[model samples]
Target: MSEKSSDTSGRPESSPESGDGAEAAPGSTPAAVSGAARVSPGRANAAATKPARASTAPVPPQDTGPDVPKVPAYLQTQPRPDVWLGKGPQPPGLLSRLRTPSPPAIGPATLWSVFATALLSALLLGDGLGPNLLIVAVPAALGAFFAARSAGRVLRPWTAVWAVGGMALLAVPALREAGWPVFLAVVSALALGSLALHGSRSWPGVLLGSLGLFPSVAGGVRWGWRGVRDRAGDSRGRVRTVVRSAAVAAVLLIVFGTLFASADAAFADLLGRLTPDVSVGDSPWRLFLFVLGAAGALAAAYSAAAPVRWDGITVRPGKARNRAEWAVPLIVLDLLFAAFIALQLVVLLGGYDKVREETGLLPAEYARQGFWQLLWATVLTLLVIALALRWAPRGGPRDRTLVRSVLGTLCVLTLVVVASALRRMDLYVDAFGLTRLRISVAAVELWLGVVLVLIIAAGVLGARMLPRAIAASAAIGVLAFGLLSPDGLIAEQNVARYDRDKRIDIEYLESLSADAVPALDTLPEPLRSCALEHFRRDLARQDTPWYASSWGEVRARDILERTPVQNHGSDCYGLGQEADERGGDEEEHSYDPY
Candidate 1:
C-alpha cells in the first residue's frame, strides 16, 4: 500500500498506488506534497468511506522546528498571557488599585482653607462643645463648599439647604447644654451633611454614603499628601528659603524679647500675658484635633467635588411575584391591622373600663403594657410595606393599582398604630410625670406617624421622591427635637405635673444639665434651691472660654448669679435621707436617645 496524504482540513486522501482496485479521486490532493504525510486511524477510516473535495489553495510548509504546544481555547482569550501562564509579575490587587491616588490634586487655596479650618479647630475645640463647635463647624462646612465650587463642582440648591441644616444642628451644642441632645444632634448633622455633600439620592445610597465618610476622610488625607508631594518638588527652593527665614526670625525674636523683658518689668508682664501657655503634653492633643478637622473638611470637599456615584449603583429588585402572590399576604396583614385598629377604637372611645375590668390594670397601665409592642408593630409594618413594594409585580395598570390599594391601606392602618403608641405614651406620662425616656419615645412615635403620611403621599403621587422626602423629614424631626430641647421639656413637664399633683422628682431634676435650669428655677423655695443647686455649683466652677460658653450655661450662670441660692448644702433637700429611707430601691433607667 502507498502512503496516504492528508489535506489542511485534516481529512485523509487516497493514493493512486493503493492496490484496492479503486482509482484516486480527481484533484484529491495537491500536486506536490509539502511534508511527509501521515493520517490518524480515525481520519483514514473516514477518508476510505467518504470522498474528499478538490483543494482550492496551495498547502503551506509545516514547521520542522521544536514543537510548541498551542494555547487552550479558554486561555487564548485571557487578557494577560503571562499572568495566565503564571509568568512575570502579577498585577496589583483590587485593594491596591483602590488605594492608589487618582488625579485632581488639592489646590493651594483649598489647602490654605483646610489649614485655617484646622487651626481654628485646634484653638476653639480645646475648650469643649459650645459656640466653639458652631464656630468651627460653620467655617469647615463653608470651606468644603467653597473648595468644591472652586474645583468646578456644581452645588445643588439642596446642598446649601443641607449645609444650613447641619450648621444649625451644630449650633445645638451652643444653645443647649444637654449631653444627649447635643450628642444626637451633632451626630445626625454629620451623617446627614455627609449624604448631602455626596448628593446621595436613594435610601441605600444615603446609608452607604454616610458610612463612606470614614474612608473618604482617609482617602482625603492620602490625596492631600500626594498633592503636597507633587508640589514639593516645584517649590523646594522657596520652602527651604521660607523655613530658614522662619527659624532665624524665631531665634532673633526669642533673644531680643528676653532682653527687652529683662529691661522692663511691665514689658515682661505684658509678654507673659500675650504668650500662649502650651505644654508639651497638650501639643499632641491639639495636633490631633487639628488633623481631625483638616481631614474632615478635606474629605467633605473631596467628596463634593468628585462624589462616588453611589446613586448610580443599581440594586436588582427581587423577581416580581404574581399580583395575588404579592398582594395576598399584605392584604391579610392589612385585615389583621384593621381588626386591631377596630379594637383600639373601642378602647379609644370608652372601653377602657372593660379592659380594666378584665386585666385589673388602670387605663394608663394597660396603655403602658402595649405601647412598646405597638411601636414595634408600626416599625415592622413600615418594613413590610418596603419589602412588598420591592417585590410587587410591575405588570400593567391593574397590578400597580393592586399594590397601591393594599400597601396604602396597610400604611393607613400603621398610622393608627403609631397614634395608639403615642397615645399610650401620653397616658403613661400623664399618670406618672414625664421622663426623658417617655418624651423621647413619644417623639419617635410622632415621627413614625409623619413617615406613614409621607408614604401615603408617595403612594398617591409617585414613589420616586419618597426616599429623599423621608430622609429630609427625619432630618427636620431631629432638628426640631434638638431645638425644642428635650431636657428642658422634661423639666417643664415634671414641674407642671408637680404643680398639679404636688409631687416631683427633685433628684431627677438635680441630675439635669443647664438646659433645664431655666425651667427648674421656677420652682418654689426649697425645691428651687434643690433643683438649681447642682447647676449653680456646676456653672460657678465651669470657667469655660468665651468661645466654649453655651447659651444654656450662660443663662444658667446669669440666673444663679442674680439670684444666689439662700440655702446650700449637700443635704439641702434631705435627698440622702429619702434615698436611705427608700433603701435605694429606685429603678435606674438607661435610655438611648437615638
Candidate 2:
C-alpha cells in the first residue's frame, strides 16, 4: 500500500503514507514504470502518467470460514479480466486501436509460431502417413509445453523433464503399429499427464482435457447465443454502421458482379476463378471428423498454452489412513514375487535344461516359451505396484518405512522379472530373427524396468504424486524409444546380420512398414529389390506432396527409381513368396495408413 499524488507544478509525487495504498490511486500507474522511477516527480514522463483515483464505492471484505487457511499474498489468486484493453503487449502504433478490435486469445507472436506449426502439420498430413506426421508432433508438443509455461502454473521440476520425453515419443509412427496396446497406452498416458498434475491426478483437469475435444463448438454456440440475446435486449443501441455498410457492399457486389459476369465471357471466367470452391453437400461424418479434429486440436493447444486454475480440483488428504491395510498387500505381493524370483534364478543357472526336457521342446522354443509369460507378468506387476501406490496410506507411525521397504522389495522383484523377460526375448530374437511382436515386447520390457526404477524413486522420494510421476515417466521413456525408429532400427540390424552371417528372413523384413525402406540399402540382391518393389508400389499409390517429405518416404522413392523393374518381381521374395502366398499379402500389408 503506497501513495502518490500530483503537486501544484503538475509533477507526480509519492507521499510517505504507509499502508494506505494511495499508490497513484489504482490502475493508472505507468505500466512500464518500476521502482523509484514511478514516483519521480521531476521525470519528463511524469506529466503523461495520470494517477488513478480510488473508487468512491467501498468493496466489502470477503468472508473466509474460520477453518479456511490464509493464503500468502503472493500465492493468492488474482482476478483475471474477461477482456483486456489498451495496446496489449505490443508497440502502440497509430493504427493499434483500429486494427485490434480484440487481440487473439493468446499473444500474436505465440499464435504465429503455433499457426506455422499447425500449417506444417496439415501439409504433412496431406501427404498421407509417414514420419512427416510424427515429425509434426514435435512442434505441437513443444507448442503445448510453451503454452503450459505461459499459463503461469507453478510446476514440479520433473514434470518438464518427463513432458519432453513424452513429446519425443509422440513423433514416432512405428510405435502406433506396434502389436500390443501398451505402446498406445503409454503415449496416451504421457499426453494426458502433460495436461494433468501428479498431485491430484487432477480429475477436474482430466475432465477439462476431455472438454478440449469440443471447446470451440460449445464456446462459440454459447457466446453467439449470448451476443444475439444482448443485441435484441439493448433498446438504445444503434444498428452497427460497419455491419450495415458491409451488408450494403455485399448486396452491390452480388448485383453488379452477376450483371457483369452475365454480360462478358471473360468476366464470367474471372468470377468463376474468384469464387470459393465450397461444398454445399459434404458427407456428415467427414465434416464431423474435420470439425472435431480442428476444434479438438485448437482447444487442446489453447489448454496446453494457457492452463486454467486447478487448485480447486486437488484431492484432499485423508486423516484416518490405515498403514497396515496398505502394507499387508504390498508385503504379500513382494513375498510372492520374491519366491518367483528365486525360481527364475534357478532356471537361469542350468535348471532351464531340466524344464526344457520336461517340456520336450528345442533350445530356441524353450527360450521363447517363458518370454511372453514373463513379459505379461512384468506388465501386470507394475499395474499392481501402481495401484498399491495410489491407495497407500499416508503419515502413520513407521508407515513410510514399512511402505517403502515393501514397495522397494516388490520393485526389485519386478526388475528381476523385467530382466528375465528381456533375456528370453533376446534369445528368441537371436534364434528366429526379428519380428514386430518380438521387438515391441522387448521395448515394453525395457520400459517396464524404467518404470520400476521410477517406482523405487517414488517410494524413496515420498512425494504425493510420485506414483503418477512414475507412471508418466515410464510411459514417456519407453515411447521415446519410438523416436529411434524402432522399425528402421530393427530392419538395419537384421539386414546387417543377414549380410554378415546369411541369417535373413526376407518374409519378415518384407512385412515391415515403409519405416524400413531406407534400412534396405545394404540388403543383397533379389530380396532388396522385392522389398523396394513393394515400397515403390506403395509410393505410387500415395499422394505424398513435396512439403511433408520424410527420410523414409524420400529414400523409398529414390530406391524404386534407381532399381531395375525386372529385379523387383516375386523372384526377390524367392520360393517363400510362392510357398506362403505372400504376393497378395504384401499388396494388402504395405504401408497404407488407416
Candidate 3:
C-alpha cells in the first residue's frame, strides 16, 4: 500500500510528465527532484508544436482545498509544469487532462439484483410510519449475501463474518422497537465488515468505504443514469420499446376506457374493479412515492454491495524510533489505572448501604449516578488503549507486558464497573418499574461487556480470532435476542413485576401497540381484561386495510383469536369493580382468557 507516494496531503498531485508516456519518477518535493535528467527531444518538439495560448495574460493559479498537494519534483523541471505534456498535439494553457473527472462505475449486475431484493423486502416489512424489524433484516440479509458475493480482491474471514453478523444485528428490531440507534449500529457494522472484507489496507479506506455507503449508492445511481443517457441514441433497445409502448397503451386505455365507462354501466363496473384503489390520499401520490422510494433503496443496496476503489486512503499508527520512549508514559498510565482499580475495589466492598448513605439519595437516584459515566469511561479507556497501541513507539517485551498487564487489568476492572452498573439498574428497576429505554440500555451494557471480554482475549491472551469472535457473538446475540422477542420480554418483565408488587399501570400497558397484547395476555384477571379492552375497542373500531397488514400487524391481530361477543365472561377487561361500576354499574363480570 505504501509503495508509491505522490503527496502526503490528501489531494490529487500532478507531474509534468504525468500524462506523457515518460516513466514516473519517485514522488518528492520540487527541491528533491531538481537533479533529474531533462526531457527528451521528442517531448520538446511536441511542446513547441502545441497551439498558441488562448490568452497572452498570465493565468491566475487556482487554490484547491486546504490540503493541497505539492507539485511533483518532475514538474519543477518544466518551464510550465501545468501545460499539456503529452505525445500528441495538445490544447493550449496549463490545464492537465489527467485531472478530468470520470463518471462513477456501476456495480456488477448481481448487485442490482440484490437492490431489487431489498426494495421488495422493504415493501413487505411495512407500509407507513412505524419501525419494522422485518424491513431492517430483509435488506440486511440481502446486503450480506451480496457483500460476500462482491467483496473485492482482499477477502478476510472477519469480513464475511461481520457482514453476516451485521445482518443479524439488524434483526434486533424483530424483538424490540427498531430504534435509530439499532439502525446506526446495523449500517456501521455492515460497512466495517464490507470494508474489512475488501481488504482495505488503511483505516481511512475502511471508514470512507463505510460512511460512503449512501454516497456511493447515490453515485452508482448517477452512473446508471448517465449510462442510460449515453445510450439515448439506441432506438432499438428493449427498454425504449417497452417505455414507448407502455406510454401509448396508457393513453389509449385512459381515453377509450373513459368513453366506454361513460357509455356502459356493466363495462364501467369491470373497469373500475381493474383500477387499483391505492393512493397516498385520494391520489396516485403514494404510487409515485413508492416508485421513488424503490429507486433510492435499489441504488443504496447496489452501492453498498459494490464499493469504489479507495486504496490510497490510509492512516496508520506512527511507530516510535525507539521502544524506550513508550516506557515511562505507559508505565504511568498503568499506575493510574491500577490506582483507579484499587479505588473501585474499595467501593465495591463498601456495600450498597454505604453508597446509599453517602449519596443521600433514594435507590432510583443512586442507581442513576456513576453508571452512565462509568460506561462512557470504559468506552474511552478502550479507545485510549487502541490509540496508544497504534501510535506506539517500538517497544521491548517489558513495554508489551506493561501494556498487556494494564489492558488486562483494565478489562477486569471494567467488568467490575459493568457488574455494578447492571446491579444499579436492577435496583432502580425494582424500586421503580421497567421502561423501554431502561431495558434497552441494560441489553446494550451487557453487549458492551461482551465486547470488553473479547478485547481482553485479543489484547492480553493474544487470541487472534477473538475479534472475529466478538463480531460473530454480537450478531448472534442480537439475532437470538430478536427471535426471543424484545417487546414480549418487556411486556413479560413489567407484567411479572406488577404481579409481584401489585403495581400494575393499566393505562401505560394500554398505551403500548398491539404488539404487546400477546404478552399482556399472560396478565391475570381484571388487569388482563383491562389491557385487552383497549385492543377490543380499537380493533373493533378501525378496519385494517388489506395492503397495510404487515407481518407485525398480522401477528398482533391473530392474538384476538375470537370476538369479544363469543363468551359470556368476555366482559371487556376491567379494573375490579371500579371500571365495571364506571361502565353503567354493571356487575363485576367474571374474566377468562378462554
Candidate 4:
C-alpha cells in the first residue's frame, strides 16, 4: 500500500512546475526524457515530494513496445524488398529504360566487320576454296547470316565470327575431303547457329525479307486477285495514287511479258531454221521466266496490300518508309532488262549454231552471257524511249494522264527487241563463220523483227486490260514460234554413251529436231558417233529439266572429265568465279549474302 502511494506521489515530483510555489522553488532542474517514456528513474522520486500543478495540461503519450526495424531514407519506398536484402545489381524497369536509349558498352567497329566479311567472300569466290564446296554457296550463306544478324545487335560479333569460320570450313572439303559425316556435322552446326543468333531490335529488315520470300512460295495466288481489282477502276481514298501505281505495274508486266515471249519465239525459230543444224545449249532464260513469274506475282501482291502493321516488334513505325514499295518495282525492271539482253546475246552468239553441232546432247553454257545482254538491253532501251515519245497513245484523264508511264514501258520493250535484232544482224556478217544462206536468214530475221514490233505496239495501244492481255498474247507467241522452229518438228530422243568402265546406257535427251542428221559423222566412235548423231537430230529444245541444256557439252564435258568425282559419281560441278568475291558465307550450300 505504501509503495503504491509513493508511485503515484512520484509523478507530481517529476512533472514540470509552472508557478512560484514550494515545488517550483529555485534550484530545481527539469528532468530529462530518455527513450520513449519521457520520464527517467532519476527524476521520478524527486518529483513525488512536490505538489502537482493546477493547470489542466494533457498527459504525454507513452511508447512502450520493443524497438521495430527501420528502412534507410534512401530506400524507404523502393519496390523490391529483395533489392534491399542484397547489395548486387538489379535490372531497371522496362518502361523507364526505353525512354532514354543508350549507346553500346563498347562502340562497334562496323567497318572492320564489313571488311572482314568482304575479304572472306573474295577468298572463297576465287576458287581458293575448290570443288565439292562451290563458290555459289558463299553468297547464300552470307546472305542468311546478314539477314539473321540484322534481327539483333547483341549477336553481331558472334555472327561475324561464325560466318567467317563457316565459310572457311566449307573450303575444307574442297581442299581435302572430310567425308560425308563431317560435312553433315558442319551443316547441322550452321543451321543451329543461324537459329540461335537471330535477333533484331528493328523489325524492318525481317519484314522485308519475309515479304520477299512470300512471292516465291505463294506463286500468282495474290497477283490474280490484285489484277482483277486493278482492272475494275475502284480508285478511292488516295485515288490518283492508286490509279497511277496500278498503271505503272500493269505497263511493266505487259512490256516485259511481250518482249520475253517474242524473244523466246524468235530463238525457237532460229534454232529450227539452222540447216546442217546444231543442238542449242541450256536456256537460263527459261529458268529466269519461271523465277520472274513467281517473283512478279509476289511483288504485285505486296504492292496491292496495305503496309504491314508495326507495333510490338518495333520502337517506331515506318522506319524504312515506302522505300521497299518503290524499290521492288525498279528491281523488277532491272532484272527483266537483264533477262531480255541475255536472250538477245544467246541468239547472236550462235547458241543455235552450237545446238546444231551438239544436237540430242546437252549444250553447256552459263548465264555469264547475262553481262553482254545487260549491256545491249540498256543501249536499246534508250533508243526505244526516244521512239515512244513520238508514237505512244495519249492517256484519258480518268487514267491519271499516265502518258509517260505507257510510253516508258513501250520503249523498254521495243528496245529489247530492236537490240536483239541488231545482235542477230551482226552475227550474219562475221567473216569468222558466215554463209550466204546465213545472210538470207538475216533478211528474214529483219522482217520478223518488224512483225514483233507491230505486234508489241498493237498489244500495248489496243488493250484496255493491259497486263492480262499482254500475258495471253505472250503465251500465244511462245506456242506459235515454238511450233515454227527451223529444226523441223521436235521429237523425244536419247543419247547413248559408253561410261569409263565400258558400260553403255541410253541417257535420256529431251527433244530432237529432224534436220540434225548431217553432223553425226564428225565425232569419235561411241561418244563421237553418239554426239554426232545427237547433233544431227537437234535434240536440245525441251524445257522440262532445269539443267538439260548444260549437259554433256564442251565446257561441261571438259570440266566434268577433269574434275575429281565426289559423292560417288554425282553430277555436281563447280560454279565459275563470282562477281563480288567479298560478300558471302563460304560453308553452307543455301547461303545468301544480300
Better of 1 and 4 by TM-score: 1
Each model's TM-score?
0.76, 0.57, 0.59, 0.23
In TM-score terms, candidate 2 sits at 0.57
* Backbone clash count for every predicted candidate, in the order shown: 0, 3, 4, 44
Residue pairs whose backbone atoms clash in candidate 3: 175-486, 323-394, 529-573, 530-573
| Segments of candidate 2 deviating more than 4 angstroms | 1-124, 129-217, 220-294, 301-332, 349-360, 386-395, 465-468, 471-475, 496-503, 563-594
Best-performing candidate as measured by lDDT: 1
CA lDDT of 12 in candidate 4?
40
Candidate 4 segments exceeding 4 Å error: 1-39, 43-527, 530-594
Worst 10 residues of 1 by lDDT: 585-594
Superior candidate under TM-score, 1 versus 3 = 1
lDDT of 3 by residue, 188-208 (tens): 455554554333434444445
TM-score of 3: 0.59
> Model 4: per-residue lDDT, tens digit, 156-275?
553354345445444433322113323433453343223223311133322332233332224223433444355345535555676688899989966776676688987556444331
State, as a TM-score between 0 and 1, how close model 1 is to the true structure. Answer: 0.76
Query: Native-vs-model 1 lDDT?
Result: 0.74
* Candidate number of the best TM-score: 1
Q: How much is the lDDT of residue 476 in candidate 2?
A: 58
Clashes, model 2? 3
